[model samples]
Target: MSNTIVANDLRKRYGDVNAVDGVSLTVEAGEFFGILGPNGAGKTTTLEIIEGLRQADAGEISVFGQSPWPRNPALLPRMGVQLQASAFFERLTAREQLRTFGSLYGVPGRKADEMLEVVGLSDKADTQVEKLSGGQAQRLSIACALVHEPELVFLDEPTAALDPQARRNLWDVLRAINTDGRTVVLTTHYMDEAEVLCDRVAIMDHGRILRSGAPAALVRGLEAAARVSVASGVMNADEARTLPGADEVTDDEVSLTISTRDAPKVVAALAERGALEGVQIKGATLEDVFLDLTGREYRA
Candidate 1:
């Protein structure tokens, strides 16, 4: 498959600090790819460089086989961007705003109407943008981005502040877009969303990618060990340590982190002692993998 986006040693600096340092990745055509990281992790900066909104201090980037820098007018109409922050004329209706954006992209007015329908904002087409709720506003932004029927779309936190229902609704819309064969690149802090929506994900921290692969592969790569939690009401740590395969024991629970090869043996040992009553066993999750790699720091 041909890559739709590519970067090699992409670097960017802000005064004395390096915002993006030696990052390299690629997105294949028609792929739904995600960039996952906390705030100030260079996720947005790297995306901006690829989107042609900001210049990189060093390294190289290409989008759809063309350099993203220097503002390629020829490529503008083919790409859609829903930035983290967007503005519009407060008095303009959602339809009006989409129509205006469509005109800028040389799209017909009917195309804007179609996009509004696709985003489920046809009922609110006549409502002023300022009157729309947060979710509605986000949907409008997406509608505007799609008005030109772009081949590639970039969404930065598209469902950041949405309620569960609204987020699910947007996820359906995104799935539909991908089913129609458009490539999508999204950045989000929501790990569940990344796992469900993206075909592959890249985890970044401190301006560099720590790992990148399909979500399931990344989760399975984390030691392939089942976590067995046993709660026996404040058992002595030493007593809990006596259990087979128990590597770590806490005040309230004893965790048996055993590889799949030894899971059956560990379970049989637990069964021999009637320790299955309050036990829980599960495979590693994306969140678990994230914590294991990133060390659970509180972000500002």
Candidate 2:
């Protein structure tokens, strides 16, 4: 597949701080690519650079084989952007807002209505923007972005404040967009969201990408054994430390991290000691891989 977005050694700075430092990535056409990181990790900065909203201090960026710089009007019409924060006229209805944006994009009236329906906001079309709930407002924003029938879409934390049901609804909409052959690039802090929605993900930290790959492949690469978590009294860290292939035991939690090869032996040992009580075995998840790579540091 041809790459729709490409960045090489991308660098951006704010005063002395490097907001995006030596970042490089390629997103294929029609791919659901996710950029993930904690707050202040440069995910938004990198996205803005590729969207032609911010100037890069160094390196190169291309979207749809063209530089996303100096305000390329030809490229702008083919791209859709749903920013993390959006504002709408307080008195404008959902339909009105969509119409306004569609007019700006030179989209037909029917196209605006179609996008509103696609985002599941048709019922609320007549409701004022200020009267709509947070989720409804968000859906309206998404509708506006798609009104132009863009080939490439950028969504930053699209589901951040949505309820579970709303988030699920948005996921379905995104899936349909991808099925229609539009490339999507999204930034999110939710690991589960990335695991479920992205065909591929790039994990960013400290202004750089630590890893990029399919979510399942990244988890499988860890090769860690099933994790066993027991109640506090069943076993202690010291006891778990003595088990075969056990590497590290989190203090006082009875959580054991063992090698995949020796997982059976470790289970047998626990069973023999009657310490299997409350023990639960689980496979590795994206969160596990994230913690392993990024540690448990608190990012502001």
lDDT by residue (tens digit), candidate 2, 1-300? 999999999999898888899999999999999998878889999999999999999999999889989889989999999999998877998998999999998888877888888988889988999998888888888888889999999999999989998888888998998899999999987888889989999988889999999999999898766766666667767878888756556644454444334667778888888887777667788888887877798876
- Please list all clashing residue pairs in model 2, or write none if there are none: none
Q: Which stretch of 10 consecutive residues in model 1 shows the poorest summed lDDT?
A: 252-261
Pairs clashing in candidate 1?
none
Give each model's whole-structure lDDT. Answer: 0.85, 0.87
Number of the predicted model whose lDDT against the real structure is largest = 2
User: Model 2 — which ten-residue stretch has the worst lDDT?
Assistant: 251-260
Scored by lDDT, model 2 comes in at: 0.87
Model 2: lDDT of residue 106: 85
TM-score for every candidate vs. truth? 0.88, 0.87
Count clashing residue pairs in model 1.
Answer: 0
